[model samples]
Target: MKIKIISSHKILYQENIISIIAPGYHGYFQILKNHTPFISILKNGCLKLESKNVKKKIKIEGGLLQVKKNLIVIIL
Candidate 1:
């Protein structure tokens, strides 16, 4: 899936990925390519993204997560 995260500060990330792991308000969750459309709120925690080239980790404050049409968009 293509994961994109935007914040008031800047674009945290925008890249192609095999998976995206985020800290959901309830708990941790993973989103893969072709993930069903959905939206959620994330509490303070970390986000993990994996790709062919490298794996990434980023800590986030509260934010919004949206999945649609094989795309994951996050905004803080």
Candidate 2:
């Protein structure tokens, strides 16, 4: 599925990915293709993005996330 990670000021990462780990307000969650739609507040932690079939991790102070139309958009 396609994914775009950003912040209030700039885009962080945009690409196709197999999975992602995000720090949610309640806790951390993982998203994969065809995952259920959701909107959640985020927390400070490392975000793991499995892009090009490789897992890459990025840390953020946290913000929000929305999953819709098979797309995952994360805001930091």
Candidate 3:
């Protein structure tokens, strides 16, 4: 799946990821390949992204996340 993290000033991240873990308003949630489409409110926390050969974590203040067609978009 593909994931993009955008902020008001710039695009923070855009890459193909195997999976991702994000901080949702209710709790934390994970998204993997071919996951169902949905939207959620993000809380101030960390976003973890994983790929075949890479793993990363990003700190976010808060944002909105949308998942559709194997694309994950997060706007801060």
Q: Cα RMSD (Å) per model?
A: 1.0, 1.2, 0.7
TM-score, structure 2 vs. true: 0.88
Model 3: per-residue Cα lDDT over 1-76, one tens digit each: 9998998899889999999999999999999999898999999999999999999999999999999999999999
Q: What is the lDDT for 25 in model 2?
A: 82
User: Highest lDDT: which candidate?
Assistant: 3
**Candidate 2's C-alpha lDDT?**
0.86
Q: What are the Cα lDDT values of the candidates?
A: 0.90, 0.86, 0.95
Candidate 1 achieves a global lDDT of: 0.90
Candidate 1 regions exceeding 4 Å error are none
Off by over 4 Å in 3: none
What is the alpha-carbon lDDT of model 3 when measured against the actual structure? 0.95
Pairing residues by index, what is the TM-score of model 3?
A: 0.96
Looking at model 1, residue 8 earns an lDDT score of: 84
Local lDDT at 42 for model 2: 84
lDDT of residue 27 for candidate 2: 82
Ranking by TM-score: 3, 1, 2
Question: Worst lDDT window (10 residues) for model 1?
Answer: 7-16
Error of 2 at 24 (Å): 1.2
